[model samples]
Target: MLTSAIWLPATLAAGLFQAARTAIQQRLRATLSVNGAGLVRYLYGLPVALALWFGYAAATSAHLPPLSPTFFGFALLGGLLQIGGTNLLIMAFGERSFVVGTAYAKTEAVQGAVFALWLLGEVLTPLVWLGIAISVVGVMTLSLGGKGLKLRDVFGALWQPAARYGLGAGLLFALTSIAVKRATQTLGDGDVVLRALTSLVAVVTLQLVMQGSYVILRERGQWRAVLGSWRTSMWVGLLAAAGSAFWFTAFASAPVALVRTVGQVEVIFTLLLGHFYLREPLKRAEALGLALVVIGVIASVVGSG
Candidate 1:
């Protein structure tokens, strides 16, 4: 459980950082919708993250992962999934509240645990399974907090052709976690460094594609709102960088299960942040979802322990 011990603080830090990421995204949206500012946010965020990693590497003497074409290929694939998932999530934000969108996204935990087991040969005990189950219930509670969910609605969402967008985003996010685990393992001792670099490359490349397309096809002013809010952009970039650094470190240090299980704390923190920062109402169902998420994730970790 030493990993768990390290993971506890990492979890706390990651949650706070994730909360900050939420704040950044809101600021981004307010300043610049999912338009130009969004693209700028993605592009600007990478360097800030890089600077932090440089500082960290300086302090820790972490060397860059020795890159071959192989390293680049693995990292490139990982970055594609990571950036694609994030793009989906950003798009979803316009359609749903951050709480709803993120809760759905956090279903990545169950997906991640499964992938870690299958791809990385990471094993979970029965207790961990219980925890995962508990967390899934919590996620569902939060996701369906608004409506009176019938079993049919859930099934409908699953089979609903229209709901495919949201489900696709979630599935892509799950795959991102899998790719990340693979890159980290492949990078060996420089897992953290590689993860940071990979994310930086992935995000920047995606932004280039998006922004270039927007520049070519859309109105010139489409990006006006994006860069207009400089203050928010700066803050969003800062928070995004900090959160990425902390999360990448956690991923490098702990087993993906424990890291992700603890990572579910983001929902709890996000709920609180939403209530206070966004003045959102806390519904009973959502509260239950939050509790279940925390308990389920904890149960899985503790049971495994």
Candidate 2:
């Protein structure tokens, strides 16, 4: 994967699938407890993750790298961080309006750049950094939901609880991305797809153990509720697993920060699906924000190559 440009499409597909996964998760939420719904993301995903790994290996006759302690160290750290980041995001959404909290969480790209630079020495070109900035601005603009709030007003609200949770989530997620990249790289240069699949399986399995156990112990009742909603829950897991597979592939091949910068297009996907698909009028601010996000994604892609 590193020898080619598959990372770009992989990242884009990751975003698209993530949007779809979130949609399914939302439907799951109607009948399941928050924990139950969240559990479905990893619980059902484990099977899919396992299937993808075995399927890829079988088809490609891929060589499995020796699993080192270092790989497990990074993968475990990434799994835990991802779990924390997700909970923080839910808190952020609860603390403020969904749009506002989501905008703040969308700062992951910028935060990812910082963490990747600090942890992995992944220095980005200036133009790529600029592109990340523009994409973030667009995300914030769309978060306004055409409420006519000034952009500065968002900054003014940073002292609130929502900002803390949002920023914290972004920070953790950035670190998660860094850890994932490091985990994949620990295998050295080899089959990119195989390496990515291996890491994905490791991370998802860790998630299943940690998060699944929690749900079983603390919210045993949620298991029945989730099972009752299996029709929707399984789709959520499938989408999440697919999204994660693409993300792992991208991270295994490219700079984590650049991949994340491109993944910011997920917000654009949400906008298109939520509004245009529903026949809602696109607000002027949202339109401008869309334009900025498009330009930013382009700049990041071009600057990286």
Off by over 4 Å in 1: 1-5, 30-38, 146-150, 156-163, 190-224
Give me the displacement of residue 58 in model 2, in angstroms: 0.8
Tens-digit lDDT track for model 2 on 1-305?
13558899999999999877765575555577666777888888989999999999999988888899999999999999988887776666567554455566778999999878888888888999999998888886776666544757776666778888888888898899999989999988888888998999999999889888988899988888877888888888899889999999999888888899899888877666555443435677777877888899999888887
Clashes of each: 3, 0
Question: TM-scores across all candidates?
Answer: 0.83, 0.92
lDDT (Cα, tens digit) per residue for candidate 1, span 1-305: 33325456655687787676765676466545455544655555767866765776678776776545665555566556655666666665666676766667676777777877887777878888778778876765676655535787566555533234445665675666566555555666544544555544454455556554765477466555655666576676666666655665666566676667778888888888878888778897676777777788768767756
Best by TM-score: 2
**TM value for model 1:** 0.83
Error of 1 at 222 (Å): 4.7
Error of 2 at 103 (Å): 3.2
